[model samples]
Target chain A: EADIYQTPRYLVIGTGKKITLECSQTMGHDKMYWYQQDPGMELHLIHYSYGVNSTEKGDLSSESTVSRIRTEHFPLTLESARPSHTSQYLCASSDLTLGAGYNEQFFGPGTRLTVL
Target chain B: AQSVSQHNHHVILSEAASLELGCNYSYGGTVNLFWYVQYPGQHLQLLLKYFSGDPLVKGIKGFEAEFIKSKFSFNLRKPSVQWSDTAEYFCAVAPSSGTYKYIFGTGTRLKVLA
Candidate 1:
């Protein structure tokens, strides 16, 4: 089983309320990613971190910001949440072992956010 | 821009029926293919992955996928599916070089009736 964890599996809040989704991994992975997925839709990468203090934006443009101060933790914060930001946020971590060009990612239970 | 495609959006089958889900990618270079399963209210887990050597790779729960380099396809199959196999299946492709990003399909929702 993967040690990746996401807090607030389900969240409901009003528009303009700032929220922070927590994601942590005990595996000490070097690569951590955050994706936004809608119901019955494909997951779109929003943010990713190669290692500590190395953060990059993914294919999808997201209004949220992320910080990777610690290797194990990658938290995403929305300054002013909107209804359009209400989607399932999934956290994933992967370790790039020697000779493995692309490693399989271990996903955490996604945080489903709803904005009213 | 590399992308993954899953033709089947939704599939329904009875117990003990054979299953096949199609997955095609746009990348022509060396790539790693993966199939992930997400059960109801559960996290996405790796069903199987194909790196090299074997064109056919078997995964847990009797799931198998064949990597066709010529066709740029990696399709998932199962001989007999059970009710517990009901879940959403996603196909992802990652190129060996250039970028570390993985492209994922829209996902196929499988429903098996017991």
Candidate 2:
């Protein structure tokens, strides 16, 4: 079955630790996004990729960086994580066609990170 | 920039009670509207969407929403909600530019008591 997956669903690490959150999709989507969400808060887009090697920063500035080396994988990495970096990170993929009006995003289960 | 607003932060209701969640957006030109629900420990999934045509759109789990263009609102409603309806609901709006960027509202946590 085709689905989006994220590794390390829950993680707890001390401040200044380096971490990488993995996201992959089998749905063969052209568009991928990464969002950061705090408990009981709205999600904020942190990064997005239109296709392989095409990365763009989103509305919310994030300390982490993302690279789309392959079409199926978009990983976010934090060189030195801080306590404020603790949040649920969600990854989503969408198949978009020009003039298609709208497209629904398929979301992953999200990775919850706690930086102590 | 486009933005979305959700009226309620938290709501508590008994099973079988009527439900309505308010959503509003600020955007110019045509836009696509959507409602997404996230159950406990589950991924966020689409409940309904409004692109064009009929203003009233029906969705899974007996959920529906009406797109009132004049009021710039797309509100979700259910005639009678069940205990399983408890979840976090988010309203999103995207400009019809064939892009996947969406502006999401602060979610509303709905608790339906059985």
Candidate 3:
């Protein structure tokens, strides 16, 4: 079946460690997004991309950065992980044809990050 | 910029009970609305969506929602819920353009007891 995939499902690293979370989709969607959440809490938009070579910051201010080098892959990087950065990062994408106020999103299983 | 808000941080219901979750959004122009459910250890999946034409929409697992434009609300409902329905439900909104980036509510954890 087609789906979005997130790598490093679980991660535990020192406060200063650099980390990258990978996301990919097989459905060929042109739009992708990254969200951060504290388990059971609300999700906050951190970054998003329209297509390859296009990216924008979300409403939430996050220290991490994301890149869309390819249409199917949108990776998020934390230059210096902090204890405050401990959270679940979710990856999602949507095809625009689902359009006109019809916002259905396809999400990955999500990557859980822990900063010690 | 757009935003989504979901009330009911946590909900507990017995099997066969009815379910409803509140959702609201802030956007001045046209937009899309959706409901997504995340089962334990699973990815978030779309339950249903309301784009246009109809205000009420039915989704998988017998869940449905109605978009009240005047109220600025899109609420998810299920006539009868099952224990297997235990999961987190999120309401989302997105502007008509851009990357179609979505703004999600915090989420409501629904626990359906057997």
Candidate 4:
């Protein structure tokens, strides 16, 4: 079982409002990632962190910003929400063990965000 | 550029029917392949993965996948599918060079009718 968790399993907000999606893990993983997905579509990487205070932008460009102040918490913030930003956001974390059997990532339940 | 493709966008199967879903990757170098399943209202979970040794890897829930290096294909298969197996399946690949970033396919939606 995965220990990752995300708050506000579903959200509905008006356009231009700022919103933050919360993600946290109890497994004490060193690597964390955020992915965006439209309904019935492939997941696109948006943001990731190697460790506390380390962040990098993923392949697909995203308007949201993420912070890694604590190893267990990685929060994504959208300055101004828009209809275009409506999608399901998934959070995943993986351990730092460098080996064949340890590369699998554990995913959170995901947050379904809707900007009206 | 690395990318993954799932040939089937949606699949419908009757109970006790054999199942196969095609997946191909564009990376030339060695890769680690993974098959993940997402049930309704649930998070993504690893069904199985192929790392190095075996070309055929078995995952949880009676799922298996064969990795063909020459074809750059890792196709998932099940001997017989049940209605409980209905879900969205995703295929992902990551290079073995210590980069943990994964490229995922669009996913295949499986519907099993009783």
Candidate 5:
């Protein structure tokens, strides 16, 4: 089973509230990613980390920020949530072992956020 | 810019019917193709992947995909689908070298009727 986990499977908050989504994996994967998916649409990459202390913005511009303080944990935070930010957030992690030949990402049960 | 395309937006099928979903990518270099499935109320999981070696790769739950480099296509197929197979399917591509970023298609939602 994929060990990745995301907290707060569903969240509903008023606009202008600050929130943080937590993601953790027991697989010890070095690469972690955050993706935002709207209903019936493709998932857009928002942020990714190659390893601890290394973070980069993905192709899609996102207002949320992420931190990778440890190999097993990566969390995303929104300074001020808006109705436009209502979407499902997915977290994934992949191993970077040499010659593993497996780039398959293990995903967490996404967090559905609603800003009212 | 590289991009992935899933021609079928939604598909409907009856139980025991054959299934095929089209996927194509626009990139000149070698790539790693993957098929992911998301059951209702579940997280996305890998169905199969083609990194190197054989063009035809089989995945769990009787799922398979063919990688055609000449056409830049990696299509998913199943001989007989079950109602439990109802879910959303996503196709993704990653370059063999450089960054590990993946380009994903819009996705195809399949509903199998019993």
Candidate 6:
């Protein structure tokens, strides 16, 4: 029921290959985030953007990079994929409001990347 | 560093049983608490959040959480859980002082048997 969307629900690529995961939202949200999660595990923040042209690294260290040229588009790219990067990449967006007022996040379907 | 802790790694319950998942955070100043749920084969969804006002805050799907500043805890509770409640739950917190970055816990897996 979320407005966010991610392409290639499942992906499998060999090591050293380049890959890019797509994320977009129609909600025009100002804050976007990229979280890495195992099949049924906790979520680790990898990247986030406050708005267009503003991107910051999250709590977790990631080999991938992201760009936020457009408000609705925030794509993540990996220069060289590794097996360690095999995890579900979840994209989410939320309002920029400070507190309360349904600060809930709307998550996309998620991209399951498998680097073999 | 601000961190969130979920005491239960795995929880099992029968249909119509009550459910409560404990969440605690370590931060000296003001904080923002949140609970997110990820259903089987689905992305994470917000369950509830606490920013200000009353200590107890309600969320979607009959879920609620209480933020006790003195205890520095925000525990998720459901009076009655259904089989559809089987999923992974994560607790996160954002320090009131800094940006909108969040620190999340490892998460708790819940299994509701029909």
TM-score list, all predictions: 0.98, 0.97, 0.94, 0.97, 0.97, 0.93
Across residues B8-97, which tens digit of lDDT does each residue of candidate 2 receive? 999999999999999999997799899999998899999998888999999999999999999999999999999999999999998886
Show model 2 residue runs off by greater than 4 Å: none
| Candidate closer to the true structure by TM-score (higher is better), 4 or 6 | 4
- Of 2 and 3, the candidate ahead on TM-score is 2
Error of 3 at A107 (Å): 0.6
Best by DockQ: 1
At residue A34, give the lDDT of candidate 6: 96
The TM-score of chain B in candidate 1 is: 0.98
Q: Tell me which of candidates 3 and 4 scores higher on DockQ.
A: 3
The digit string of per-residue lDDT tens for model 6 on A50-86 reads: 9999999997999999999999999999999999999
Candidate 3 lDDT tens digits, A3-116: 899999999999899999999999998889999988666788899888999999987899999999999999999999999999999998887663355447888989999999
**C-alpha positional error of residue A72 in candidate 2 after TM-score superposition, expressed in Å:** 0.9
Q: Give the lowest summed-lDDT range of ten residues in model 1 chain A.
A: A94-103
Residue A23 in candidate 2, Cα distance off native in Å:
0.3
- Second chain only: TM-score per model? 0.98, 0.97, 0.96, 0.98, 0.99, 0.97
The residue-by-residue lDDT of candidate 3 on B27-114, one tens digit each, is 8777788898889888889898878888999899899999998888999999999999999999988767655667788899999999
**What would the per-residue lDDT of candidate 4 be over residues A2-106, giving only the tens digit for each residue?**
399999899999999999999999998999999999877889999999999999999999999999999999999999999999999999998745566447889
lDDT of 2: 0.93
Instruction: Supply DockQ values for each candidate.
Output: 0.82, 0.78, 0.75, 0.73, 0.73, 0.55
Candidate 5 lDDT over B1-114, as tens digits, reads 999999999999999999999999999988889999999989899999998898999999999999998999999999999999999999999887788888889999999999
**Whole-model Cα lDDT per candidate?**
0.93, 0.93, 0.88, 0.93, 0.94, 0.89
Q: Which ten residues in a row have the lowest lDDT in candidate 6 chain A?
A: A96-105
Native A-B contact fraction in model 5: 0.67
lDDT of 1: 0.93
lDDT of 1 at B107: 99
Please tell me the TM-score of chain A for candidate 1.
0.96
Q: Could you give candidate 4's fraction of true interface contacts?
A: 0.69
Q: For candidate 3, state the interface root-mean-square deviation in angstroms to 1 decimal.
A: 1.7
